[model samples]
Target: MRYLRSRVVTFCISYALWLTLSFSVDWQHLLIGLLVSLFAAFLMGDMFAEQAHKWFSPRRYLWFMIYVFVFTWECFKANLDVARRVLNPHLPINPGIVKVKTILKTESGLTFLANFITLTPGTLSVDVNREEGVLYIHWIDVKTQDVEEASRIIVSKFERILKEVLE
Candidate 1:
């Protein structure tokens, strides 16, 4: 029963990803997608076996959608900010790594958050201390040296949403 559940979970996850990335749905395309997704499901059975139940809901997907919009808006805003700074005569940049703690417990969640941070305008995720729940981010405009404040500014935006989606 558990094995079946895991297989189903993996199939769902892989197929969802495939659909998101695929533009066409012809028979040839569908066959290849099915084969690849099944292969991935067989290999990563344990990933979705346990936590998949927590995320298998419409509400979770709704939260994920919200996160995507919020992240996209932030990305656009950050790009403009960076461009404005670059175009201006005064180069205002405080390029330094600040330690901020993350509450995401899963590796995938942390990795996604790290990628999000890196993709954002002025921030770059330098390193992650998984054991410490800490991430070192190089910020262009770091307003505080306090770790909690930094986390609130940089990581909190996605942590709760990511937890709902991935954890």
Candidate 2:
């Protein structure tokens, strides 16, 4: 029963992705998308968590939507900051790598956090230490060397929401 549920969940997600990416309502495209989504679901269905039904929960979807907005706003702010630094040569960019701890226990949560940081302008995710629950990040401006402070500055906002959405 669990395996069947996983496959159904996978199929729905895959088909939605297909339709979104293809942006077509034509019969041929629909048929092809269905076939491809079925193939993908069949191959990767078992990889999903046993509690795959959580993915269909409206609460999780709402949290994911909120996360997207937060991420986009952060990216926009980072772009402005980076642009400001670029325009003003003496804006003081102390480029260096810093380590910060993450409370996200799941691999997917950590990966999403890393990706969100990397996608933002002034920061890059260099590496992830899952065992230690730490992430190495390259920051354009080093505000403080303290791990707790750095984690708060770079990770807290995303981490809180991600804990709800992904973890």
Candidate 3:
């Protein structure tokens, strides 16, 4: 029962993604997408998270859309900051790998957070320690060495939204 449900869920998501990416409604494209999605779902459905029902939540999708805007804004600001530092010789960058704590328990949530951090300019996600619930991030400007302070500065912006969307 659980296996069948996972496959169905995976197929739905895979087919949706294919449609979005292909951006074609033609019967030929739809047929190819269906075949590909079915093949993907069949091979990887069992690997889907146990709490796969979360994918069906409308609230999660809303939060995810909000998160996209927040992420884009953060990236834009980071780009400007990095550009300023690059252009100005007086601005000192305190570069260091700082450890920040994360409250996210799920693997997908953690991965999303890490990827977001890495994607943002002037900061890079060096590593994630799941057991310790910590992420090692290399920041262009280290504001504080304190764990809580760093987490608040670096992780809080994305973490809260990610918890709603993925956790």
Candidate 4:
């Protein structure tokens, strides 16, 4: 009963957002759109239930939004730095892979952190050790090979945000 209610609420909110973003609704069109959304929601019932719980939690959702904003700002700064390096005659490119240890316990949190690292311009997640909870990342311009430094950069910025969201 709880799952059903959550799913319905999730579907309605999603449908409303879609309708607002995609089309100018008349009475007939609104009816049709609602029907289609309900069908889709029913098809993805379990997903809606899970996602609805995650998505509706105000604290978690707020942190996630903040994470995205901070990440975007950092990416922008990193892009400019990279561009400057590329344009200069003396290209200070220190490319290398660094193995960073992960402290996040949950799989979802770890996955989010890995994806976040990859999405950022300067770093890419090369491998993940699920058993040990470690991440190997290829950095475009590595300033230091020190594992602690590298891990600090990743964990303090992104991993923390992911932990807040997922855990």
RMSD of 3: 2.0
The model with the greater lDDT, 1 or 2, is: 2
Cα lDDT for residue 129, candidate 1: 89
| lDDT (Cα, tens digit) per residue for candidate 3, span 119-158 | 7867899999999999999998888999999999888988
Q: Candidate 1 residues 61-160, lDDT tens each?
A: 8988998998899899888988999998988887788999999978888898999998787899999989989999999887898999999999897898
Local error of candidate 3 at 41, Å? 0.3
TM-score of 3: 0.87
Q: Which scores greater on lDDT, model 2 or model 4?
A: 2
Residue 93 in candidate 2, Cα distance off native in Å: 1.1
Superposed Cα deviation of residue 116, candidate 3 (Å): 1.8
Q: Model 1: runs farther than 4 Å from truth?
A: 1-3, 13-29, 47-50
Residue 94 lDDT (model 4): 84
**CA lDDT of every candidate:** 0.86, 0.88, 0.89, 0.79
lDDT of 1 at 48: 59
Residue-level lDDT tens digits of model 2 in 1-167:
44888888889988999899989899999999999988887888888654576777888889999999988998898888888998996887889999999999887898899999997768899999999999999999889889999999999988989999876
TM-scores, one per candidate: 0.81, 0.88, 0.87, 0.75
Error of 3 at 109 (Å): 0.7
